[model samples]
Target: GPGCVLGLFTNRFFVLRGYDMKTYDRLNRILILLVILSFVMAIPAFAQTPSSDPDEKAYEEAKQDAMGICPPIFLRDENGNTINPVSRVNADVPYSPKQTCGKCHDYDKITQGYHFNQGKGEKMTKNFAQTYPWCTSPGQYGGRW
Candidate 1:
């Protein structure tokens, strides 16, 4: 009797030319067993328990839930007005990133960061992974923005 094979693979028909039904069933069962084994083996890699101790893991989870996450606070301008630039519809008008961001954060401190300085002038002790060609000379790693 010729029939469709359905399980792990697609509903494909194996031609029963010389092979019997018993052999086909056994092969299908083997394929299903292999798929199940593969899934079982891959479970440990995906299911990370974080900590070894169950109590500690539970405590860490509970602490995260208890502490919770802070909601984003909508910032206001110096005039006590809510400064939402997204609401403004203008094609010609261009807003400065520094001026807009400085309302909540210090823009001056951000300009003095590592990226601002020239790559050749700086003397860095740490080895940066990305700066391979430029900083390979001596003691250098930082890049110019």
Candidate 2:
């Protein structure tokens, strides 16, 4: 009687058509086993420490060294004139970052970097060319957005 009641309850609420109690029990056991396996697999990921890669270690050290030692910045205009905010003559002109930061940094070399270039002259793969016919390069500059 108890087995019949349980079967009726499972069938009514769970709507497990054509599956007997044994099949339902097996499915439950399989689901439980899969959940346990997932947790077991994730343990190694949770236990991981910082990376041992040389490049990553160097990047971290450099980041730490550069944290709070920045000097005051002097904003300069396109013609290498210092932009005094209260001055009337060059007050309206926009300060050029290339002229300002470029005093210490190389503008040409920095703009030639991967991010700024954005695949402007890179060769496209055959599959990518075929798939995206409008694209001339792999990145945003020459490729269709």
Top TM-score model: 2
For 1-145, candidate 1 gives per-residue lDDT tens digits of 3333344333233443566557678887887788799999999998975787899989988878866753344444544445555675342344454555666678788767665443546455555435554553333324322
Best candidate, lDDT:
2
Clash pairs, candidate 2, are none
In order of appearance, the predictions have TM-scores of 0.27, 0.33
Model 2 has an lDDT value of 0.74
Candidate 2 per-residue lDDT, tens place, 55-125, comes to: 99899888777765555676789998888886665778878878998877898998777776798878899
Each candidate's root-mean-square deviation in Å?
A: 18.1, 18.5
The global Cα lDDT (0 to 1) of model 1 is 0.57
